[model samples]
Target: MNVILRRLGMALLILFLAGPAYAQIDTAAREAYLVDATTGTVLLDKDGERAMPPASMSKIMTVYAVLDRIRQGRLSLEYTLPVSERAWRMGGSKMFVEIGDDIRVEDLLRGVIVQSGNDACVVLAEGLSGSEEAFANELNRLADDIGLRDSAFRNATGWPAEGHVMSARDLAHLAHRLITDFPDHYHYYSELEFTWNDIRQSNRNPLLYRNVGADGLKTGHTEEAGYGLTASAVQNDRRLILVVTGLESQRQRAEEAERLMRWGFREFENFELFEAGAMIEEADVWLGASSTVPLVAQNDVLVTMRHAAREEMTAKVVYDGPIAAPLQAGQQIATLRIEGPGIAGHEVPLVAGVDVPPAGYFQRIYQKARYLLLERQ
Candidate 1:
């Protein structure tokens, strides 16, 4: 199949309003990243790719690794692990477990996700790999294997270590994976609070109590890393992932996160252009039993654009004129290109909607004659 591209029109350029531009957001956080999950659009990015101290936010990977082990049957939530002297002695938010006591994996998960307990992280690290050093190695290995190219791990607790680091974008990617990969266990992050040994601690995540669609995520802070958070939310069926770091204080971190989430939800809208297998258009068939065959999208096409734009989208459907038969159903024979101002363009595969066999000799002759006549007209 051959395909051609043509510029639809100039009207679509006006999709982004020209007056003073869309409202700009200024953040007090030293680094930030926001993405429209539905459309994969980077709505806001500030040093998103720069590797920096991720603080407790790095625990997301620890949680991820443990959850993966659970999924692989290497570990179970009910399994109990001995708290090492090292874990018990670790400072910063504590789950308050005795050194000799055995703690359930599920409770430790809560300690990390809800309380940001450094001790809990240590317990998990030691329990999973027999030592934090080995677990850190696994962290680096898993990070490289999973496409987190810029992140490096020194330890599981995000305690002040020499080379512990991750990027804002990397954290957002990890958050996406956690949500999509472990739906069964993701509820732990959203839990408002977790209690153990008669002591209860509320989740540190700032978005949970807000009316906004914020659900689950992790928060981090260290003297060196400042404050950081990797947050995700679903509003009106649209999900967004945001990562922010290097804030002066916890208040700034919480405020900045909420503001960014609000802006992402209010400023953009998701448009579903075509559902999977939905006919996009029709293309003429050359010397085929049928005159034409439908061109359908292979998957749902969703685009994100500014909420108040006035211009209609421009779409170009390109394919070889009169595709030659015998065509097979679901064969990719065309391309659907869509563009809009202030939104990234999309090129999606277009498939043949149905089978089209080659025409008989007489039918081929007649089709050729008809084409010639139409050309003359």
Candidate 2:
């Protein structure tokens, strides 16, 4: 079958008067990070990997571990766990549970996520692992398993303890996993308030109250760590994860998070080049039953480009042509090179769409002679 190659835009005709410009705006936070969640592109990073106290933001990891256990069928949300004296006496934030109270796992989750209750975190931890120390170990183990190397947990409550640290990048990554891996439970973070023992505490996450499409995540604060927030927002089907830490005040953390998210969505956009299994071009086949085979993309080709410069987008299908048969389906035979304004060129794999067996000897001889005559002419 014949396939027509899609023509790329004439990008050379357009001149980019300036170099690629990302947001150069200053933020009040000591460390910050932003990412395009859908494309997995890091749009901004300012000391994002410098490990420091994450405050209560680390509680997201504890939530992740609990959700993972539930997913594995080892625990259930309805199961009740006992509150220890350690949980009751904890300071910072409190869900107001008394010692010996049996709290459902789901309510505890709400307390930890929505209320940012240090006491609730301890309760869940001790109940899950018999002691807070064992739970901290489990937290570290889970972090390692999930590739969060830059983070460590000394306790599940993020209660200003020594050696409890997480970088802004790591926090953003953890937020991504929580949203992507446990969609069912992630809604707990977006709950406006949770009440236990007649004490109603609102979610500390500042983005929830803003006009932006911000949703679930966490906020953290301590005298040592300042204020920090790990936030996510979805606009126009594109989601972004942002982390801002060490701001002077809760107001600054909220403003910085919102500003960065706005910049990310305004400056960059995802451009769809081709869908998966779409024929991008055709590749010539030598000594094959068919003279040509279709080249198709293995997955969707989405490129992040500057919003002001998407018209400069262009793409080309490149391959060493006239491949010798027999060719198998799904064999990688070409590369789809794409380039656009304010972005580096990227290559995606293109694979053979069908199998092709070698032609009979006489047929090959005739085709070769025909090729030689054509070349001479």
Candidate 3:
């Protein structure tokens, strides 16, 4: 059989649009990353891998670590952890728990998530792992397991330290995990406000305050790290995760994050390309009971791209043919490659859609003779 690659313009309705995948926009952050949660497509990236101070944004990981323990049945929301002197003495944000007081896991989680309480994070850390230092080890281990390639945690709170750091991509990945992995607990990030010990504070995430379908996320700021945010939102049933750091102020962080979120949802969209078992091609068969075998995918194919770029997409069918018969239905054989402007590229497996048993003895012999005659000519 010889390799054959055929343009699928006739077989496929690939929309060819004008312009790039998405329009480019300027940003103020030193590092940034944006991704669509529904399709897992990265829409924007700027110095995304460069690890920098994440400030309180690292609290997301701390919350993740604590939630992981709860997820494993090692702890529960009803359980309580004692606040240590170290936890009480922590200088940044506070849940205001008295030293030696036992606090509920539920409230402590809120303190870290909605309140950005440094003291609360330390309490959860020491309670879960016996010490904050030891808990940092657990956080790193969990980070490795979760693919946090450019993150290093020296403490539960994202305090300014010489080596403590996280990249925008790492923060965005963490946000995605929180939203997808712990759906039951993710509501904490969306809480408009939380009160503990007669003190209340609103969620610092700017997107949550707006009507742009934003919910759940954390914001951060420190002299060394400037201001930062890691957030997610759903608009028109589409979810997007964004991580940005190194802005100059709180206002800049909110404005920039919201603008990027709106831009991402406006520019990109999810498209259903094909359904499972859809006949993608009718491939010729050699010495078979049937003249051709249908080709199909095992599952549906979907892609995300900018509006103009989707119109410019192209597709093709590729296979080694003429395929020998006795082919069975659903036999994996061919490939479908799809490409377009603003799309990196996508490939779907094409399987044999129908059976084609070998032909009768006389028919087989006739096909073999015909092949030889054609080759000689």
Candidate 4:
């Protein structure tokens, strides 16, 4: 009877401890995910890993590849390329690149982004790779290099193709990588409007104006692909990447993206686990010159969670203790894991805060004796 009572009491205590940690995540999209750009931690996801048509969001890779070429000095934004008839005939969303007209690479980028111009994409692809097919091969190669396993590119313009597809998680990964890896050229993704041949068009990504902190990204729509968006925003020095795919309408895509962004920014707080090289705690030593050695973090540790449950968080550090001396600085020594309500726990590797050289011969013998004695403690 006493054992039963104790078990029931522990169950009640666990529920009481966890009750306040739950927050309703109101994200509405067929395929969606949110990730911390700095930490690469997935905060929310629904069918995010499943492959789906990215529609025009595929252009994100197209632009990324082009920017890479420009950075390598193989291409220049000021370079001019003649518009071909094939580029002019591109079916959907055009910057009116007419045959025989020459346009600068810089202006073509604005056209592709602001107007969702298939024509502009073709011109850029042909200009950079000498052909659209070659440019797409480059896109796929780069995607593999960047860890986008489920993404494949068939064309530069993101026009519907049989095998051209990407998962929501992969899209977010690509967007986050672009911003973090190439900040110098990332500003171009935020351009709101562009003019070509005296006609102006606005970018389709609605979150740029509707959501605070929303900076830049891309949007796409096709009868078969539906409406999709890959958006990102920064708040309190933390940047978040969001991907939403296959919405029924443009209005729904905008509304849902804003809602998801708001839910993430307003509800969650990011916690720093440890500062880079900051000592976590000291490990006990036996017969060494120093009685204790410091355990540190190799990198900044961070996690995101619901703001109200911050007090409930707990951290546990695990490592092989009484480490043999001659430990080098920056060597991985342990792991720090954090757990709290409503958040899945995450681990960050801990490292030796400083070098610890072995003791002299006499000291080594003494340490062995100490270990034998301490085993009883």
Candidate 5:
């Protein structure tokens, strides 16, 4: 049985006993979420987990589904898809694709991403799964594999339909995945405009045109869903993904996206708390040659939090002890959990710094008897 202990070891270093205080932001969006992409720290969450209509913002998933197929060698950027009557009849946004025309895959991606073309989505869906409805089933399967728990996709176009929904957190996660998983295709989100068939349409994402480091993602709008945007940006190699939905207008969407992006980047920063192989403390061992085993980290432990919370955060060493003997060096023996205001929760693994072989047989027996006798006392 593992004994639970909350006591800090002799190596307690950081001062962190005060009450916790996380950062907060005022947002006009009905749903908003901001996170540090590199560290997976959630900086802001306001109705972020609640499922709602994502409007065209759902196109990001459609695009993701296509990109994944490309990665699996089932599709290629050079592949062409035929525009069907269903696609040509699609309403809302338009890629101006003509029926019976075979459009290149690259062009279709641009049409869907840059123009938010419902029709382009249908073409890609039809080409991939023989129909948009079938492709939507494939999308749900792919979404499950990608770990989207609260999203349900009913159409490739993100058109108004029952049971079509996504949480802000899910959307932000999708944005982060696109940036990290598809470096080659991610550049498409940054394109300012695309021209096809004598028509030019600018990308709908407002962040791309601004001075901020924002790059890729999509925007969604419907009378029921309002305006929403899934945006990601990098400042100094640290990326932050922001998802906002239910804004009043296009201008509000632009303003809220920029404001949240600025707030997230400016308020949060990454700090390394411990280096790899650094000794943190010593944990007691049971019936071992040595009474204590040095505890150390196996990797760098870095945390992202508000700048003000660095001094307030407390680090605690938690482990079951006295740890049993016969342990090899580098065996994980404890967790270094951190908590405080403006800080995201983190639990860094602390491993044994040295071998802990069992004590001699007689010594083990003697220790056991002594422990039993002491228990009686």
Candidate 6:
């Protein structure tokens, strides 16, 4: 009886411990979120979707739309934009571009990114769309397409306006999209120094220099909005995005951003879900040149999880099975899902490893004949 009671007590104790194990969730951040940029996993969130004044950080969307135009061949970086009186009159964070002066698009971008130049933003807007109002419309359109549901833009320069608001989660999502979608153009945000017409300025994101792995992002401030920063850092191959808004001072913004980044690095680790071009699994090919084709991920798949729970994770590949032939090498074919306790599941796209052309009529006939002959043997 004593032994049986001890065994039952052990079972009850195990259940008690297991119950809390499943309840352990990462709910850090007072008004913030940490996401896996590649996989879109919400690692942590606190009022993440609530809208608030973004201040100058709204310029990130403006830059994204401009860069998109450049990539689409609608505009060139070398194209010269004429500054207007309206552009020069922008109040906060001026690049000081004089009216009637011609500035290259590249230079203006540097001014806007490194110096947070409202003047530069206006110049780009007018240069691209012939008016800032029209450009603001385009910004709103782009925001809609990119899933920034809570954001709206009333001006191209993110000047104080009634509808110019974005949530911290939205800004972090935008920052991630900027970095991942346009790595070539994203370097402009991290530029520490930029000089225009003999005026030198530096990026306002202070954590860039002080934090170990801090890089590209933006800063904002106004009497109404207070000081805020959207900061990102990569450490030990794991990247984290942090957005802090409504702080008292620039120093406080920087300190809090760094603190949050450190907490992310210390508490969580990135787990690779799939490797680029690596075959995740095989897909059956019917009536094709090959009997089976391999599905792969176009890029490395990764997710952030708490460090202590790394060993308890499982990765599963999910996709339509036995995909038809004539498959293109880069076609998306599947998704890799990573599951673990205390961490949300993350899914990333898997692509075809190699092109597989459909078998010709004659090839199919030959295959059938060979199969029949082999069976007869």
Best by TM-score: 4
Instruction: Give the clashing pairs for model 1.
Output: none
Order the candidate numbers by lDDT, best to worst. 5, 3, 1, 2, 4, 6
lDDT of each: 0.84, 0.83, 0.85, 0.79, 0.87, 0.76
What are the per-model numbers of colliding residue pairs? 0, 0, 5, 0, 3, 1
Model 4 TM-score, all chains together: 0.89
Model 3, 1-377: lDDT tens digits are 12334431223323443355566578998898999886667888899999999999999999998889889999999999998898999998877878989999999999998889999999998898988889999999999999999999999999998789999999999999988899999988899899998998888888988777988799999998999999899977789999888899889988999999988988888877678888767777789987678888898776788766634667666677778889988897777777766556667788999888999999999988987997798
lDDT (tens digit, per residue) of candidate 6 on 1-377: 01111120111000110111222233223366666564565655667888888888888888999889888899888999999999998888988899899999999888888999999999999988889889999998999888897898888777888978889889998999888888898888778898887888888888889855877788988887788888888876667787877788777777777776787678666666556777656666656789777767777766555655535555656655446678888888666665666545656667778889989999888867876786698
The candidate that achieves the highest lDDT relative to the unseen native structure? 5
Kindly provide the TM-score of model 3 when superposed on the true structure, using C-alpha atoms.
0.86
User: Residue 261 in model 6: shift from native, Å?
Assistant: 1.0
Measured with C-alpha atoms, the lDDT of residue 255 in candidate 4 is: 92
- lDDT for model 1 comes to 0.84
- lDDT, residue 130, model 1: 90
Consecutive 10-residue window with the lowest summed lDDT within model 6? 8-17
User: Would you estimate the TM-scores of all the predictions?
Assistant: 0.87, 0.86, 0.86, 0.89, 0.88, 0.75
By lDDT, the better pick of 2 and 3 is: 3
Where is the poorest 10-residue window by lDDT in model 4? 8-17
Among all windows of 10 consecutive residues in model 3, the one with the lowest summed lDDT is 1-10
Report residue 222 deviation for candidate 2 (angstroms).
Answer: 1.9
| Poorly placed runs, candidate 2 (over 4 Å) | 1-23, 311-324, 337-347, 364-377
Clashing pairs in 6: 296-351
Q: Model 5: residues >4 Å from true position, as ranges?
A: 1-20, 287-292, 343-345, 353-377
- CA-RMSD of model 6: 9.0
* Reference-based TM-score, model 2: 0.86
